[model samples]
Target: MGPLYCALISQIAIILAFAIIGAGLKYIDDAFDEDRFSKKKAISIAPIIVLIWICLSLFDSVSATILFSILFAVLLTGKIDNLIFKVSTIALISILFLTQMLNLLWIPLVFLTLMGVADEKGNDYVDNHATLKLVEFLFSYRFCMKMGLLSLCILTLLPWLYLLAFLAHDGAYESVRMLGKISVAHQRKKKHTIAISPTVNE
Candidate 1:
């Protein structure tokens, strides 16, 4: 293939990898949250996921790398409570420091991280308290980050393609979450059936 074609393929590969890794991270979190797996298992797998995510971010351009690193750090620190996640995030932050990835784009980082935090908090609130359909729908899918990224793109602060990649990551994360919910429901149904089957037979 020509160099252009090769470069296109490489970009596609990176986006796909991000999607898969994002899904894996969500799966582990969902497993723990839904009681499908032990906290120990989630903790054990978190470091590997964090490491891979950091390594992949390095492959992007410097601007994208800094954005990804800052956003990732913000989300991890602001939302996650697990000890392993906190430790991994600290390590990730240290990597950013050592590599000089932390730059003077603090304003944008603050804006994006605030959007991320809003999404996280809004999602939780909507899940338990929100009654309006539109409100629930927006937060349920975590649209805050999407909007923030789009704003940045419109302002020429970030490339448009990064928004698409972020969508891919969010899409994969939601898909895994939905599948996990279904699996948990199915397991509950199966156990209920099994428990009553013997009485029905008797």
Candidate 2:
């Protein structure tokens, strides 16, 4: 209906694209054996994908930021395997987190969070700092802009909301992978014990 609404749709389009790509990467990894195609590595490229997206952001900030957030969420969810950590991290970032664009600055928080990433922490920090910048508009703007601000926050939080759903999903794939390892170990032990008991029966 207007430029603002058009911008909203464009950002949504980018967000959907990242979601589809994230899903496609997972499916591809699942289709192959772990040795042939590591799902970890597949999702690991999420940062690179996002870095490239950020480069494209210069041309379209709104759309680029929205899409990057979605992919970053997918990447973040892939790395962290704790519910309480994710929940607590989200709460803190929603309230206490801060970021800068020109310099890419954030507080030194070592807690496991989506806000950062490093070799030691694995997910130390995200390249995008504008994650919550639009929060001001939602509360500080005039009545005329209330609808627009509401729409922006909803769009901005979509990636985060999606990650929450993924984390709460019916047993994450990592858990299933761990179970598979345990099952193999259990079967091997059972067979070994049976083989040893026959020799002792004599």
The best candidate in terms of TM-score: 1
Query: Candidate 2 deviates by what RMSD?
Result: 14.6
Whole-model Cα lDDT per candidate?
0.71, 0.39
lDDT of 2 at 80: 32
TM-scores of the candidates are: 0.83, 0.28
Q: Can you list the residue pairs that collide in candidate 1?
A: none
The Cα RMSD in angstroms, rounded to one decimal, for candidate 1 relative to the true structure is 2.9
lDDT for each residue of candidate 2 in 136-183, tens digit (9 for 90 to 100):
332222222223223434656323433332232212334444554666
Task: Name the weakest run of 10 consecutive residues (lDDT summed) in model 2.
Answer: 104-113
lDDT of 1 by residue, 59-149 (tens): 5652345345435645654665555656776776777778776443666666777787787778778878947999898977767878987
Q: Give the poorly placed runs of model 1, Cα more than 4 Å off.
A: 37-44, 61-78, 103-107
Q: Candidate 2: deviation at residue 143, Å?
A: 34
